[model samples]
Each structure stands twice: as structure tokens, then as C-alpha cells.
Target: MRDASAVITKKLYEEDAYRTEFDAVLVSVRRKEDSVLDVVLDQTCFFPEEGGQCPDRGELGGLSVLDVQIEGNEIHHYLEAPKDALPEAGAGIHGKIDWPFRFSNMQQHSGEHLFSGTVHRRYGFENVGFHLSPSEVTLDFDGVIPEQDIPELEREVNAAIWSNIPSVVRMTQREDREGLTYRSKIDLEGEVRIVTFPGIDSCACCAPHVARTGEIGICKVVSMIRWKGGVRVSILCGKRALEHFQKLHGIVVQTANDLSTSMENIFPQVVKLKNERQQLLARLKDASLKELQYAAKEIASDEEHALLFSSGAELPAVRKVVNALCAEHPGYCGVFVGNDEEGYSFVIGSRQLDCAGLGRQLQETLGSKGGGRPEMIQGSVARKREEIEGAIFSLTRP
Candidate 1:
């Protein structure tokens, strides 16, 4: 019921301006079935999600642009339709972005380059991976870096920031860049946009970047893990770095208050508390085992079979008690307990009796599942405790 032939113009480089209001003529419009109006401007400043950096978000003429994508050379702006009717094709429209969000992304992305470049330059480590997300930017390096060297690397990157080096964006012909030095993990064979972090890093990229290295503000390494024959470094930059510090400071304060200790001594206090709790739990487990042993003596049946059912004992404790009881008695001893979210678990064993046949019969009768050696079997069932008991009795009574 709507026209499909509108024209729009796209402005390719709006990120260069820290803040700008722009106007463009509608180049074309295509309506998808989901009610999203795919409108294209002859030119646009909205950067599409490309080269790992997410797209810029903003509004066009008061309509929310939910997503932006590049198909071929045209940048498609997906926006919600007005209640009355869609905007006509060929109409001029204004576009703007949330500058703060865009600026934060620029800071984090540029900071990642400096970090990666410094690591590579100092240790001969290759950057094997990179991810730029809304929350943080992460880089993976090819080898383990010593803990003592991390501070030095951070200092090196911040030193570049202090230098106020110009972040150059250059377009060079493929042949003209023959001897130029840059870090490229993949082969690039065409005309490319090179982003250079002055003396720190130079790489071919198409994403929008800040004007100067100092604009990156700061870079912080949060964690490092060995991965894929290499080390993965998790990092936060600029605003995110500041946010991480504030969050950790708040936690330290809250922990200190809860433990009735000063912030300066919280670390040692927490370590002491953890050690004390572990010792107490170990003693409790030993006491529980003694009680279970005494309980087993009273419940041991004179008949050939003994059955024990408990509701809340942990799985490991139940298993320990069941195995000990079966070893002491020659007849069948089965233990049943409720598992966390997993309905019920049964452990059955016998010293002289064949438990494998009984275990299979129980599984088939109760519609349950599990298996073990010829002398013992353990598994879970979906039925209630009463239903499981009824099924087990039916299988074992004969």
C-alpha cells in the first residue's frame, strides 16, 4: 500500500566532526515485510558495523534509526514508519548521532591499537585477535607476557598519549605502500585506508577514529588468559577504564563494611575468613560422616536387602555413605536423595548380588536413566520419590 521508489543521499564521513547536523536528499526507499523502512540517503555519517567496530546510533528527522548497514556502496538506514504514512521519496531529511557514545567508542578503539602495538613492539608478540564491543575492547597476543612487564607496557602506551601524536588517516595506492611499515595480520591487496597511531601503531582499517592519540585518554588491562596457543588480554579503555575502577572501589568498600574491617586490611581479612570457612566445612563433613556411620548401624536390616532414603543430604555425602554401607554388608543397599533441580538420584550396590541387572530393570521400569559397574549403579530419574520407590520395589521384589 506504500510507494517503493524513493531517492536518498548518504554522507560518508560524519565521524570526522565531533558533532554535526547534516541534511541529505533521499536516494531510495524499500519497504520490508517487518514494517522497517529501509531508507537510503545520498550521503550519511552513520558508520555501519564493519571491521569489528559497531555502528553509530542516532535519529533521522525525529524517527529512531534502529540499525544501519552497508550493502554494496549504499548505507541503508532502517527506521520506524510514522503513524500516518511513510515519508515520501526524494524529501530532504536531517540526521544526527549521540556524540558521547560515538566518542567513547573512538576512545576505546584507538586505545586498543596503542596497547596492541606496544605489546608487539616490546615483546615480539603478534596480536592474533581483537574484539570491539559496546562494553569493552579486548586483544589476544601470541605468547605469555610476564606480570612485571604489564606496568611498563601501560606506561609506554600512555607515554604516546602524552606525546599528543596525530592519528593520521591516509588513503594510499596498493603499489605506493610497498615499503611502508604497518601491522597487518591478513593479506591486503587493494587501495586501503591506513590508520596510524603516530609512533605506536599503523594498520589498515576502515572504521572511524579520533584525531589524536591523547584523545584515547587511558588504557587498562583487566585480565589475561592462555588461549589457542597464545594469551588473551581483556582490556577497558577511557570511560570504561574509569568505570571499572569505580566499581571495584565500591565493592572493596562494601566488603570492608560487611566484614567490620578497614578498607586497607580487607584483602588480608577476606583471605583469613576464606581459610577459616574452609576448615570449618572440613570438620563439619567429618562429623557428618561419623553420624551417617552410626545411623547405618541402626538401619542395617537383618534381611538380605537394606534401603535408605534421605531428602537433603549432598550428592557426594550420599554416595560416600552408600558405598561404605554396601562394603560392610553382603546384601543390597540402595540410597536415594533429591538432587538440585534434577528430580531424584539413586545409588544402588551389592557385595554378593548382581546389581547391574537390577539397575537396568529399575531404569526401564521407572523410565529413568543411568549405568555403572556390575556391583554398583548410579543415575537420575524424573519421577517423584514415592513413584521411584514403587518402581524399584516392583523390579526388586521378585
Candidate 2:
């Protein structure tokens, strides 16, 4: 095996991003796993995996390329083919990239560049980080950009997309790089590859992009969240954005039909349904609380302990029951909800005994998970009612 460090992979994608079919020499081949082989090519059109973007997926020598990575100057193509299935080193091989996939990626990358450039130009926020996956693209910024202002950015990006601005890459040498302006994460020296979209964006990028902005189709900012000190925003472009909008509209339409209201009235209809749900829950809680309290009272004043289980009772109602029983009961008082088969959620209280001690006993003995103050403890345990009763009664009062 020759040192791949000396094997320079002529990146044909840089020459023409649209070029899908190409032939290259198999410079080096190594076995990474029993089922996987890593092969390096001399000159290839496949783009290796880089930060902010995934590697191009395609076939190399008729075998599916599992992954592509750039190490030193060699572009490694990972394939699931056995060594016996592949040709020997120095053999000429032919492969073609997944064109639609590559085009979509190009659209997304170019769209991101345009949007980031617009934000930098208008709001002066530098793009601090980026991640591009098959399903989504998230761009991080060094400063905050409110949700309300993102519409303007989207409009600007879409306008640029529609303008069909030509995409050009300027290979600037270190000596000629002086006085030239561009957006980059690092202070680039040496020969820098600068991809420019006319007046919109000029940034140091090594990925292959579309020939024109119009090829991006459209740009849409889907969501944003506050991050470290700035914000991370998710965006969709081209067919992806259109598909998203289509899916969302379908959901809205279905929701409106289910609610028996027009799309425009869905919000009010949902609010109405929510109010009805709240009223029903309030009534349920009132009934549950009264029933639980009545059960508590049924425990004679002479009784030292009380344990009540109400299957449909809410936690708040159970807690109230525990509180009422503890006011009189001298021993442990607890109310549990749920059946023996499904386990139970419980609120246990004691006036004279230590509930925290019981909590630990429950946790250690039955592997129950929860804790609270000494006076009260709340947790869930899967033990049957009989087992739980035994565990609680066997422990001496702490």
C-alpha cells in the first residue's frame, strides 16, 4: 500500500458541480471491516463529507458508496463490497453521484449562504455554526434575530433566489488575497476557495454549489430557538420547503374538517374545545376530591392509620385526601391511584411518623422511585396492594 498522503485527489466536482459521471484510478484500497472496504480515488467527482454538509452518496465501480471522507489529500470512498469484488489498485473505475440528492444539497447550501450573507449585511450577525442534513438545515448566529424579523430575511433570500444570480468561485492566492473581502469562520491564508453569489454572498466554502441562485427555488425559515448567547434557526429550501408547506396545509385542512369549522376559524374552535375540556376536568376533580375526602372521613377517629385507593382520582385530589387524613390519623396515611396490575401513583402522609423514612423503605424494599419532606412523600411503585401494605406496616416508625 502506497502512502495516500502523496495521492492527490483531483476534485472534479470543483471543476463542474453538475458533473455526475466520472472515471478515476483506484489509488489505494484497504479493508476497514469484514463487510466494508475503504478505497481512495485519484480524480473523482464525489464530494467528501465536510462540516455543515453530508458526503455525496453514489456508486463507485458499480458498488454503492457508503460514505466519503477526505483525509490529507486523498478522498476515501467507503463501499460495502468485499475486496474480491473490487478491482486491484491502479485499475480504472467509473462512478456517478446521486444527482437529485446532490442538487438538493446544492440548493440548500446556496440558500444558506444567501440567507447568512443577507443577515450579515443587514443585521451584522455572523454565522457561527451550521449543520446540514438530509431532512433539515440549521444555521447558528453570533447575535439574536427575533422571530418577527426573520420574515424579512426570508423575503430577501427568496428574492435573491428568484433573481437567478450567477454563482462564481474565485480561487484567490495568499498574495492576491489582500484587500479582498469575504465572510469566513477562520482567517483564511494560502489559496482560498471563495464562492460568491454576486452582491449577496461571498464566503470561503469548499462544497460544490448550484450554478445560479434561481436553482434554489425558494427559502423558508421554519423555526428558531435561543442558544448559547445567540440563536439557532432551522430553514428549508427548494422542494423540501414546498413539501413541508404541503404537509402542513394537509394537516390544517384535516384538523379544520374534524373540528367542523373552516381553516380560518380553527383557532377559535380549538379554544372553544379547550375551554370545554377545562370545565369537564374541573367537574371531575371536584367529584374525585369529594369522594376521596368522604373515604378519609370513613376512617374512624379512633383509627391510627388510613390507606385509600381511588382508581380514577387525580394526584391533586389524592394529595388533598392525604392532607385531610394526616390531620387526624396518628399513623401513616396514603391515597393511591391505579390498579395493582398497573402499579400505583401514591401520596403518603403521616402526622406523628416520618414519611421520608417510609419513602426510603419503599424505594429500597420495592424499588419505588420518589421522595419528599418527612411529613409527606410521593412516588410510584409497581408492587401489589398486599405487598405495599406489608412493606409499610413492617417498618418501625422513624
Candidate 3:
């Protein structure tokens, strides 16, 4: 028998992706101070996180394998359940991987390959990056892609998926890797694993993928964002795509019923509501400006300080009122909006005193927060109205 420490766990996942469970002998168990056990198995179907794919999680002998890692060509399973007696070295254990999670990853990964290959061939752009999760896959391209071309690209991807092309994995020796071009993010030195989709693409990857394009079911480009002078596209494949579409459809139906409109007319109704809102806001701003001007004139005297409080008022209107008062008197003019517990939105200005200095002094006195230019300052303060007014009146004494 090979030395326990010298044992290399067979990677059953690499050979047969459908293999969900395996019986393996424990080679060694290293006990830690924290009571967790790191066990080395003679064989495992669990895939460790590598090459941008998340690691597989499952059960080992009724205990959870919280994590699996690769160290020095040996796969170590990090087992939890500290209170349970640790399995001895050379003991047999049954390992079962979460099949649904593994299959979801496989579908998204394989779907990305097909879609990225389509993009590369159609536009001559390189797939700069790829990320696969259980819910979605994102592909980053090295160059800009025209927005007009996205719909056609999506069509091409779905066509390939419907074709049910075989995804073949071939292993080749280092010296014989000539004339076999494939897309790879890193340089390879040892035996290379090539994943090829007939009439689509070939790339070097170690992650387990679905055996056929049709297994991806459907592919949807849900979103695209400009990233690092390129483009990042979010995709949903297979059941993920179905679930996403169903959720969005539900939202649309709810919106249509709420608006009392048909699904096709939801867009026009939303636009109408937005336009009406803009008109109402314009009228309200006009009325608020008039009201503020009237309130400013009602101050009665060119006093050293004038303080006003209004509820649910616009900050811009408050600033205008303060400006009008500042134009008339060389005193501190301020406005406070909102309530005591939540703090007040304040705008203060002065021609006689340095507004910035006054703001700093108030912040120091009340331990508040805010700042400004020499003539004007604006911020929110947690202090109450009476306390704030008293501080300002004291600072602006003639």
C-alpha cells in the first residue's frame, strides 16, 4: 500500500461529470486545535475551486465538507462537526456531491463558451474574461461591440444552443500541441485539456462543462455594461434564463394591472406618467419660489440675523430665499427644513461675516457636520432648531 501521505486522490469529476457520489478511503487525518479535521482521501468526485469556477460542496460520511482545496497535487477536504469523533486514517467514507449546484455551474459555463465563441467569430473580439456562477455567467470582451449588433449576436447564440452541438474534451501532450489553436488566458507547459464545440469554438479549460450545447436550453444576455474600455455582458442560461424571464414577466404583469393598461401599452403609460410628473414639478417650483420671495420680504427689519423654517421644502428654493436676504442685509441668513430627530437641511449665507468660518464654528459648538465657501455654506445638522438658532444668533451679535 502507498504511504498515506503520498496518496493522490483520483479526480473522478474530471473523467465523468455525472458521477455524483464516490466511496473513498481516508488516507490521513490531521487534527487542528480548533477541533476541525483536514482529511485526505484516496479518491473524490468533489471539484475544488479553480480556474474561476466555484468549488463543489457536499457531504462526507454524514459530516459536511465545508471546503475542498488543492495543495501539492493532493485534495484536502475540510470537514466540520467538531463534536463528532474524527474518522481514522484508512477508514472508508462515502462522499456525495450536490448534483443540482454542480449541474447549474456546468450549464452556465458551457453556455458562456458558445456565446463567447459566437461573439469572437462575429466581431473578431477576444473574450478577455469570463465568470461563472450558479445563477449567471458574465463575459468581458477586449473591445467595444456595437449596440445594434447585440440582437443578432443573441440570435446566433440561441441558434447554436438549439443545434445541440457536441462539446468534446480532448487531452493532448505538450509536444503534439502544434496546429491545434485554442483560446487560453494563461500559458500552458504540461498536458493541455482542450474543450471544443463543433462549429463553434475550442478553448483550454479545466472546469467541468455540459456535454452538449442543447443542455444549455436557452441563453439570454440580460445586461451589458461598459467596463475598462470594453464591455461586460451578463448572461442567464438553461433554467436560470427561464427563472429570470418568469420573474420579469411577473413584474410586468403586476405593473400593467396597476396601471390598468395592456402589457404592450405599459411603456406608453409610464412615459405619460413621467411627463405629467415633470409638468407638476415645474409648476410647484414656480409657486414655491414666489412663496419664498414673499416670506423674505416679511422679515420686517434688516436685523443681524433672520431664521426661517419650512416643511418638505426644496433646498434650491431655500438657497434662493437666503440669497435674497443676504443681498439686503450684511447679516447671517439661514433656512432649516425637516425635523428635530432626523436633523435639519440647512443653507446659510452672509455678506458681513465669513460664512465658511461661521459654519466651522457652529460645527465645533454642536459637533455637527457641514462646510462651504467664504460667502455660503450648506449641510445637514443633527442639532435641534432652537439650539441651532441660538448658536447662530450668538455668533452674529452686532
Candidate 4:
């Protein structure tokens, strides 16, 4: 194992200078059991995923910096490398990030602050939770806001964006920060970064954010539902918000054309069509049952055996009919078979016969197994009609 002390360094707060790119000295390298080295730099632009914010992704010294983590105010950089001579502790290194991804995160995170702040200010709703992931940023409110109010909230937040209000980040002493409140669920022990969206929202957050509300472009409330005794709102901000609208607009147009109706009337038309389809299905099912009942009466065998088999009907329905018929005729044997998604279900019953022994005979012949009382046996098997009939005939042979 390499010296752990040589591989840890100070975490540079990069959001303070979001656009800057610079080099740093290799401060240490810690070797792990897997042979990969954890390299530390004297200063870094890599932001570790913390405080509900995702980690900054970038490369260092032409090698992929797979992860950035903070331990006791020190930042450790996990790197990907095969076994090779490691860079010296004091070696100079270059670092760069895919700026687009970083900038997008900044915009989305800032938008969340504004949205959460506005909710807090307008409705006294606390932001109880937050998650900044690769796909979307989500926030959970501490209380429910009515469905009718969501669009109004969206409008107000975007109005702030259109106003082009400048956002400011300030650090204040604990005493001076008193009475000047912000949204934070966790207790803060030291200096805090207070992000303020002017005339709109404010919160104490460690995540990187854009300089102005207008930079967030558009804010969209994609979904809102009750969660954890409160409400959870999933939002798409900046480029994500724009992309969501574009995709939904395309779908709306396609649906309207397919239905030969205007987009405005699509919902009512769809509801009407669905109602008609359900009614037709119900009528078809009733007619099929009536036909089955007629067929059952015609095929009622005067012989001691009652055979019921149907490919068109569901197994459950066929079994119910067979059970009813068996209950009506006490001495006769019943065998019900029907095709289903699981291949077939065969139910055999006779008040006077040892059906368990018959079931065992069927299992041995058809490679299936099930058990029941001496008078009735029920089970399922994956077998064709001919194969099942042959098995049953062999068990009942004279």
C-alpha cells in the first residue's frame, strides 16, 4: 500500500469561478488493494457529489478521474489506470471537464433553488428533499399544493426568469445570518453559502449554480403528486425543459392527425373511444358465455363421465363451469381442460373415485404434478390436447 498521507489534498470550491480551467500539482498517490491509485491534487475543479448534488465529471492528466469524494475537508480523486509507474507526489497535472454537462447542472440546480424558494415563500412549503441526478433534478415539498396551483407557480417562477433577476452567493457570519433565513433541512455548523434569487427565492446550498435566473431559460413542472405526507414535484429546467416541450408537442401533433381531430378535442375523443371499446368487449364476453351454456346442455353425456374442453375460453372460466356442473351431478366424474397463457389447466373430480391416484397417474404420463383430496384433483401442465387426452385415457383404461 502507498502512503495515504501523500494522496490527499484541499478541495477547491470551483463554482466560485465556474468558467476557469487551470493545472494543479500532484500532491499524493494512495495505492489500493485493486492496484488502482487514488491521486490527489493541491487544488482541483472536480466537484464531488455531495449535498444532493451530483459529482463533477472530468479528466485529469489524460486519465479518467472516475470519482471525486470529500473526506474531512480533503478531496480524494479516484483514477483509472493499469499497473504503471505512478506520477510523483509533486508532479504537475492538467484537468479539464466537459463544460456542457457542468453548465447544464448549474442551470438545473439554480432553477430548483428558485422554484423551491418560491414555494417556500408563497405557501410556507419547506423543501424536505432534493436529488440532482444525470437525467432530472427533483424536489419534495413538505406540504401539499393543490393541482390548480401548480400552473400558477410555474408561471410565477418563469416570470422571475423573464425579469432577469441577478442571483448572488454570499457567506455570512453565524450571528449576522440570524433572522436572515434560507431553506436548509440539515443543520449547518460552520460558514454557509446563501444563494439568493433576487425578489424570488433564497436557500443555503453547497451546489454550483448559474449567475442569474434568466440563465435557467425556462422552468417546467413535469409532474406533481402527493408524497411522504406532502407533495413531490419533478421538474425539468433549462435545456431539459425545452426538450420535454418539443417532444410532447410532436406527440400531440401525431395523435391529433391519427385521430382526425384537433389537439384541443383529443382527450374527449379518446375517452369516448375507450368507453365504446369496453362496452363491446363486455357484450362479446356475455355472448360467449351464453354460447358455452348452450353447448354444455347439448353435450351433457348420459355416460358416467363429464368431459368439458374449450380452446376459445379462458381456463378459469372453463373451470368454474365444470365445478358448477359437477356440483349439480354428484355421481358423475368431471374433467375440465382449457388453453391459457400457461399452456393448459386440467381439473378432475369424482365423488366416488380416488382422484389423487388418478392425478398421480396423469403426472407420471404427462410429466406434471399436483395434489388434492381423494375426490377432486386440480393442477396445471404444459401439454398439447392430444397428449393430455392420451394420458387421461391411459389412466381410465378398462
Candidate 5:
């Protein structure tokens, strides 16, 4: 609304954000590519991508508007079309904004303001960064937030939403502002657009937001990760939050039913299953190691090298057998576990030959991956067992 006479495109979005359609005349048109057109409108309801909020997408003159961007005073609307079908400059056109997309973005953006404002007031932390995508929204803060206070922060955020506070927007002159406190990432010049959430936040922004906090439905902080010198918090708001909860609930219900227990007992049951699996794996590994060691003693090792293969054995068990064989045979010892189609987990050792060089040789020739010391090496290869055995036996040839 700041001196519409000075700007070319009349941004109808600034007047009424809820307005989804508008009639506008084309100010200019240029064909950017064979099927792509850049059309500027005299007035538009589609909001351009600004202030970290994504562009509003919809149809303009029956052509799909892929993106909307601001270049100085003009809002460039990127459209798809054939050259013959494009509207000429000065021609009137209909502009439609996708309401659902706009509403979802508004919910998340406004929800973030509420949360950021509350955290800033309570913890003295600044919101340094924000990103909103279709799948996730993340806010980066300038200071660490205590983990114990997160629940309290969530409670406060939900409380502010439940209060159904109205968000106010004002355009102020740059010089008229004095001794006024606000959150801004940069020092904006000219006319400044200030968005205020009463008793919660006042920040400079150029994006459309929900008129009331209650429209955001619910705001849930999903994750927090240590970032730079501060913390990054991930959140889901409105419909996204509801969908996330439902998906998780479905998984919990399925798991509880499968275990023949209630949801409350799912955690203990999963932990018990995990512990049982670990104990079984340990016993199986011990038996495999003993069996491999006994088989290594039984092999006729008059030659300088020996190789053995086991089915479905772990890498650790293979390494144990290789170490024992190398201690006894003194030349080259190799153990391969798993079938040829799935590749083999291999361990090679030698007190005499260089196992690292052999591993490298196999890697270069057979496209295998792994490495270790000269005396002992571990890796995997997709080559057939016969090919690997032939290569090992060739080293023992007279």
C-alpha cells in the first residue's frame, strides 16, 4: 500500500490476502524460452516468493504460473504456454491463486512467529534463520535452548494459539520510527512492513500470514539438532502436524496389535525383542567361530596358502578364523562368508605375504571394496568363489 503510484504492479495481495482471484491487464510480456513466458500484470493477487515464504502458484489467463518473483517494483509471473496463445501487453487477464497452498504456508509462517516470539521473550534468543518447505519447517536460533524448557515452550505456544490473537500489519515510514523495538534480520530501507502479534511478537516481514493464531490448528516442534553456535528446531503446524500425528499413531497401533499388547506396553516389548535378538546373534557367532577354527585345523595345509568359505557367517567370525589360520599356517589365510550372488564378506591375513596388497589387487581387478593392514585385511567382493579361490591359489603356485 506504500505509494501505489510509484510501483508498476498493483500487488492485490497486500490489500486482501484472502482474495484468491483478480482481474488484471498485462503490463508487459516476454518469451523467456520456447514454451516459457514471463508476464507482468498491472494488478495481481498471487504473492511472490519473499521473506523466506514460497511463491503462490496458480493460473493466469488459463496458463499455469510456475513461479512469481519480484524484480524491483514489478512482480514477474513466470508462465507456461505456446507462443501463439500468450496474451499481449495491455490485454485483460484473470489471475487465480491456489488457496490451499497459500493457507498452509500462512499457517506455518504465522505459527513460527508465535513460537519465535515466545522463545525470544523467555530465553533472550534470536531467530537467526528460517526455512519453509512442503515437507518441513525449521527455525535456527542464535542461542542454545535448554531441553527441559521445551515442553513449557510448547505449552506457551499452544496457549498463545488458543488465545486466538489477531495479527496486525502496518506500513511505517523509515524516519518516523524512533525508540521502537522489533525483530529484523536486515536494516530495511524505504517503507517498512511490520507484522505484530499482540504481546507476542513484532517483526518486519513481507509475507502473507494467517489473520488469527487459532487458524494454525496446532504447532508441534518435531526435532532439535545442534547447529553452528546455537540450535535448529524443526516443527509441523496445522494440517501437517495432524498428518504427522496420525501416521505415527497408525504405526504404534499396528505394532501394538502385532505384539498382542496395548500401546502403553509397546516400548517395553520392543526392548525385550531387541535384547533377545542380540543374545541369539552372540550365541550363533560363538558357534560359528568354534566350527571354523576346528575346520581350519582339519584342512590339509602342505601348501603356502589356504582358503575357506562359510554360509551366512558374520565378518567378525570370519576374521577370528583367519587370525587362527594365519597363526598356524604362517603363509596366507583367507575366509569368505556369504554367497556369490550377494557378494562375500572376506577376511585375509598373512604372517609372510602382504594381505593389504592382495586386497588392493582384488579391488582393482574385481571391483571389490575394503582395506586394512599389511598383515590382516577385510573386504567384500561380488566375484564368484571359484574366481576368488583361483586368485588365492595362484599366489601359492611353484
Candidate 6:
């Protein structure tokens, strides 16, 4: 393996976060995998994946940069291109970062810092962990922030953003940092890079950020859930926040239209429909019970097996009818609810046979599902009534 630690790539991004283009000389190239080369340059404007933040993406030598990672002091640019097509070591190369992607990450990180700072100030909760990616951003706090206080906390973050506070980046020398108070998730060994938003937050960090809070656009706290002993808060910022809110607004509008009500009354309409559905179901159940009783009276008093096909009857009504038939008949008695096309839910009981065995036989023969005790069984089957009747009625006592 090549000793890349000996050769440190100059970090242009540390000097200028918005440096989208840069010229450099290739220092080394190693094959990472098929069509992927880990190319190191003398200097780079790209930011590698670090500190819970995703790497900056773009192109190097006109080939797509797949990912970036840091090893010791060297930044490895994983490029997607045939080895022969890439420039050799010592050759001049050009690198470009996708500005939109980089800026979006900056907004999210800055927004997170602002929110965490607010929580720390008010509740003394430390940000235990954080993760930032293109699709999601989450901050895990060491203590719970009251749910009611979150709205105010979120408002405070946006208020700071609208205040347009300038972000200050400075290295606190280990010698001069005798009594420095800053938010840090870990103990520092040497000089600490402190990112500060005056009167908002001051935290030890290494990632490049927006010049001012206003550039963050917005921060929307989407959810907070109990995690570990504290809470994990998910937020959306800048373009992602806008996109998320747009989708949510679309759902509300469509739901209101479907409910035949104004957007503001969609909730009330939904509640009303839910109540009405319950009332209708109760009426249907009462009618099904009466129908089952009438059908029970029509069965021959001395039949070998009493079987009835019922429609729209609930499970309780069907089970009641089967139990009543079983008391007066010598063989299996069952009530099936539903038609040939939709499949059937059944309740079978017997006074003189093992219904559990019958259920197993039906399951193996008819592709049905369910089971119960020896005296009774409940299950569903997909076969037509003609096949089900023939199977149950033809059975003799075991």
C-alpha cells in the first residue's frame, strides 16, 4: 500500500467554501475497484465525508466523482472512469463541485447547529449525535425538550436566521483556550475550529458553513421521537424544507377535495364519516343476527349435517348459528359468510365429531386458513359453496 499520509492534500475548501473549481496536480492514483480509482491531488476544493455530513459531489478530470473520503491528512477522490482514461500522476487535473448540493448541506448543518444551540441554551441538553445527508437530517439530544416548547424553539432558530447573524470561524489555540466555553461532543487534542453565530451558537466543528444565518433560508422541525433515553429530532432545511411542505400541502388539499369540504374542515369531515361508518356497521350486525336466527329455524330438525351459506353476516352471528345447529344435529354444522367470488369466512362446530380434524382436512384439501378446539373451529376458505358443502356433508363420524 502507498503511504498517502506522508503527502497531505492542501484543503482549498478550508480557505474558500464556495471554491467550485480548482486546478491541481495528481499526486497518486490507486485502483479501488473495477472502473473506480482513488485519485489524490496535490490540492483539492472538495470536502470529504466527515462529521456526520455527506461528501461534496462533482467531477474530476471530466469523470464523475463518486465519493470523497479523508485518510490521515490526504483526501481521496473516488472517481468513476477507466484507469487508462484518467490522467497519470504528476498530470494537471481540474476539479469541480456541484454548488447546489454543497450549499444545501451547508444550510442543513447551519440550521441544525442553530436549533441545537437553542435547545442547549434553554434546557441544558447536549446534542449527543447528529447525521446529515441529502435525504435526512437528525439530531439526537441528551435530554428531552418538552413537546410544547419545540414550536417556540423552532421559531427562535428562524428568528436568528432572519436576523442575518454573521457566522464566525476561528481556531482556538490549545494554549490560549484556557477557559473557553463552547459546545463540543468530544475532548479536543489541539487547536479547535469553533464555528460561531454570535448570540446563537458557538460550537467546535470542522465543516464549512454558510457565511450568515440568513443564507440558511429556513429550518422546519418535522418530528421528534423518544430515542435511547432522550429524543431524536428530525428537521428539514432550505430547499428540502420547501419541497417537504409542498408535498404535505398537496396531501391536505387532495384530502379536503375527497371529503367534499374546505381544507380547514377536512379533519372534522373525516371524524364525521368515521362515526357514520360505525353506526352503519352496528345496524348491519343487528340485521345479520336476525337473518341467522331465521335460517337456523329453516334447517331440518333431523338432518345428518346442517350447513348454511350466509351473506354479509359478521363473525359473531355466524358462530352463534353454527353452535345452535350443532346442539340439534348429529354431524358437523357450519355457517359460511360471503359469496363464491369473494371467498368465505366459516365457523364450524359439532356435538359428535372432532371439528379440529375436519378443519385440518379442509385446510389441506381446500387451501383454507385457521384452526380451533376439538368441538368447534373457525377458518376462511376460497372454494365455492358447492365444493365446501360436498366436503363437509360427506364426512362420517370418526
After superposition, which runs of candidate 6 have C-alpha atoms over 4 Å from their true positions? Answer: 82-86, 300-303, 310-312, 338-343, 382-398
Task: Work out the TM-score per prediction.
Answer: 0.76, 0.84, 0.83, 0.83, 0.86, 0.91
Task: Name every residue pair that clashes in candidate 5.
Answer: none
Better structure of 3 and 5 per TM-score:
5
Question: Candidate 4's residue-wise lDDT over 332-370, tens digit each?
Answer: 354444564455666677766687888787778877667
Candidate 2 stretches with Cα past 4 Å from truth are 1-3, 296-307, 312-334, 339-342, 347-378, 383-398
Worst 10 residues of 6 by lDDT: 389-398
* lDDT of model 3, residue 177: 78
Model 1: per-residue Cα lDDT over 212-247, one tens digit each:
877878888898878787788888777888899999
Query: Candidate 3, residues 84-148: lDDT per residue as tens digits?
Result: 57788878999999898888888888888988888888887788888775555789998888888
Scored against the true structure, residue 27 in model 5 reaches a CA lDDT of 79
Report the lDDT tens digits of candidate 6 across residue range 1-398. 34566888998987787789999988898888889999998899899998898999999989999999998889999999884775678889999999999999999999999999999999999998999988999999989888998889889999999999999888788976678778999989877789999999989998879999999999999999998899999999898899999999999999988888999899888899999999998998788888888988998898878888877888877887888898889788888988999999999899888999999889877888999998999989998999998777565544
User: Cα-based RMSD of the predictions, in order?
Assistant: 4.8, 3.7, 3.6, 3.7, 3.7, 2.6
Predicted structure 2: clash tally: 0
**TM-score between model 3 and native:** 0.83
The CA lDDT at 210 in model 5 is 88
Point out the higher-scoring one by lDDT: 3 or 5: 5
Give Cα distance to truth, residue 62, candidate 5, Å.
Answer: 1.2
Worst-scoring 10-residue span by lDDT in model 2? 389-398
